[model samples]
Target chain A: MRRAIGLILLLVLAAFLVSGMLLVHPFGAPYPTDMDDYIIENAQNQTGSNSVVASVVFDYRGLDTLGEATILFTAVTGVLLLLRAQKRKEGGS
Target chain B: MLSKIVRTVANQLVLFILIFGLYVIAHGHLTPGGGFQGGAVVVSGVVMLLVAFSSQDLKKSVRERVLSIMESTGALIFAILGFAGLGTVFFYNFLVGSPIFGRIPPTGPNSGDFWTGGFIPLMNFAVGLKVIAGLSAVVLAIALFARGEEMEE
Candidate 1:
């Protein structure tokens, strides 16, 4: 029973991934492009960036980048702290 | 350390990898890659160097304190840029029309110019620094730990 369920789930995910790569738009063929269209059209002129993706990431979605940077910082600090403790124990003993 | 031939090859390739990574970060506003992607590329090169030279040799040079400072600097620059546009709003494109890194191109796709993106290039550089320092430190620590050694505290 578990094997069958796992196989079905894997097939579903694989289909979704392949379809995405093939650019197969879903049922509602063209969803509202209101925001997407505006950004695509104006991102270059408004942000003075050649790469639309860069503009969206660093300008349009700057807060998200800030959050990501914070996460990286925290994770690195955590790793260093944990490792240092291991070193300390070795020395202490 | 690996064979002498492998060590020589890694040493030769390291500079090119660093250059390519910097190019990706520098032209981020004009290219497909950004800081994280470029930093990952650079880190891969570093890993190759580590494998070729051994973790002990790397520990001698890749000081943890310096890496920590670099990571902090990158984060500081990112935060400062975010706050610089506080007049209009947080993370505003305040440099859109200024003389420095603010030259809007013709609408639609065109040949990319370096000095076009407002503060994005700066942000790219900041993030690139952060990723390079933070990830290298983590990887170096792990490599040392595995070999029963401690990184310089």
Candidate 2:
């Protein structure tokens, strides 16, 4: 059938897409710039704390932490609401 | 008897653990430990008490009302602290102020003091209480509700 031929063509296209990624990674080189060093130097100067990751999380990326906390709060609220018991009718009939 | 002695020891141990957990939460900013860990530890102590004594017996010591209030108030304090930091810097690290909000010495050391810091220790204690109460409520509710008899819903 024509559908079988179309499926084969799609499979070939998928194979090409996956194989293309293998060709790109080997030749890629990483370049280290002076800006990276300056960033480290300035961070040390401003925040007395030596913990770069903590500084980034609590200070520079604080908005991200706030958003994450809001997401957690929302999820907890949703779970609590779902778990709450529903009121039933009082009459025994 | 042996059971009586075991119960006495367990009670004392649970109390000590709870106090240590609170200390960890209180000194979180200065020390390596913080709220979540301390809260979990405190809840473990609560679990110990529940296990050593019956659930009904444990209920006599700590009420649901107190736990719920602790949770809600902790959340409120956390929100207030968030707003307090908005004046200076973003989440400006409010763990550097005095215990009584705006008191003498304009707070304490830069980053080393345990009692110092704006709202860090308070927030830690609040979060500790909140987590312990919330988790204990969840576990207690589940345990009670799963008893085969139909609950009021």
Candidate 3:
């Protein structure tokens, strides 16, 4: 019974994914291009960057970048702290 | 640590890799790549060196303290830049009209200039530095651990 239910769930997920893809806008031509259009129109003059994507990442959505940096820093710190602790234990014995 | 040929190739290739990474980071405002992507490229090169010369040899030069300092510097700069724009709003592109990196590109398609991008390029460089240092330190730690050794202090 459990295996049958799992199979049915997997099939349902696959059907949803396929149907969603089929109904979605084709490739790069997304339906909601309002945000894209706005950025492309003013990014160069406003941010003074030729690359719209960079302008978006570093200027328009800078808080997102800040959060990403924080995550990376936190991860690196955790790894270093754990590794250093192991090293200390190794040295003591 | 591998063959002599591998070591020699890595020695010659590392410089070019560094140059390419810088190019990506520097031209971030005008090109497809940016801080995170360029930093990943540079870290890949560092990993190449680590494999070619052994982590034990590489860690001697790549101090964890220095990396930690660099990461802190990048994060600090990012925060400061955000705060600087609080006169209008956060990340307000304050340098758009000032002398430094303030040249607006011609509308539509045109050749890109380096003396533009307001604070984006600077932010790119900062993030690139943070990523390169942070990731290299992590990789070095992992490599040393794999060999049942700890990174040098």
Candidate 4:
């Protein structure tokens, strides 16, 4: 019975994934590229960066990058906290 | 642990890898890679060192405190740069018209100027430093713990 239920769940997940994939637009044919076109055309002039992707990431969407940096900082803090050696007290139990 | 031959090769190649990573980070505004990519490359070099050498030897050279300081400094620098633009807007391109990193490029594709991109390059450098220090510190911490575990066994 357990195996049967697991198989049913797997089948349901596969059906959902397949349906989602089918609904995706065809490769290299994206819809509503107005934003893309605008960024490509004016990124260099506005951001003064030759790399459009860099301008978009660092200039246009700066807050998102800041958040990513914060996440990395928090992760490092967690790692340090978990791995640091513990010191024993002489008087305490 | 790796063999002596692997260790020697890693030691010799580490410098080149680090230089390449720095180049990528510095030229991020004009090239394909940015802060994250360049920082990952640097971390890969550090990982190579960690794999080639013993934890004891690594501890002698690279300290956890130094890496932690670097990580914090990078984050602080990024936040400060953002705040500098607070008069206009959050993350504003305040340096665009200024002398530093303010050279506006032509509309079409061409070779990029180094002193352009306003605050973008600065932000990239900050992020790159943060990623390099953070990831290397994490790996170093894990490696140290693993060494302790082995010693316990």
All models: lDDT? 0.91, 0.58, 0.90, 0.88
* DockQ top scorer: 3
Q: What is the lDDT of residue A35 in candidate 3?
A: 88
Worst 10 residues of 3 chain A by lDDT: A84-93
Q: Which digits, one per residue and each the tens of the lDDT, describe model 2 over residues B5-119?
A: 7778888998889888888777664556666668778888877766667666665666656766666676666666667788886567554433442221222234343334344
Query: lDDT (0-100) at residue A33 of candidate 1?
Result: 79
Give lDDT tens digits, candidate 3, residues B32-133.
999899999999999999889998888788788898899899888988888999999888888887788989889888899999999998899999999998
Please give, for residues A49-88, the per-residue lDDT of candidate 1 as tens digits. 9898999999988999999999999999999988873424
CAPRI-style docking class of model 1 based on DockQ: medium
True contacts kept of 3: 0.83
**What residue runs in model 2 are displaced by over 4 Å at the alpha carbon?**
A1-93, B1-5, B94-111, B148-153
CAPRI-style docking class of model 3 based on DockQ: medium
Checking candidate 1 for backbone clashes, the offending pairs are none
- Put down candidate 4 lDDT per residue, B34-142, tens digits, no spaces: 8899999999999999889977788778877788889999999999999999999988889997999899988787777899899988988999999999999888878
Native contact recovery (fnat) for each candidate is: 0.90, 0.05, 0.83, 0.86
lDDT of 4 at A41: 90
Error of 4 at B83 (Å): 0.8
**Candidates sorted by lDDT, descending order?**
1, 3, 4, 2
Question: Backbone collision count in every prediction?
Answer: 0, 8, 0, 0
lDDT of 1 by residue, B1-153 (tens): 999999999999999999999999999999899898888889989899999999999988889999999999999999999999999898998898999899998888788889889999999999999999999999999999899887766
Q: How do the residues A1-93 of candidate 2 rate in per-residue lDDT, one tens digit apiece?
A: 899999999999999998997766465563564755554554333433233443343345556644544454455445445455555476556
- Interface Cα RMSD, each model: 1.0, 6.1, 1.3, 4.0
The TM-score, computed over Cα atoms with residue i paired to residue i, of candidate 3 is 0.92
Error of 2 at B9 (Å): 2.2
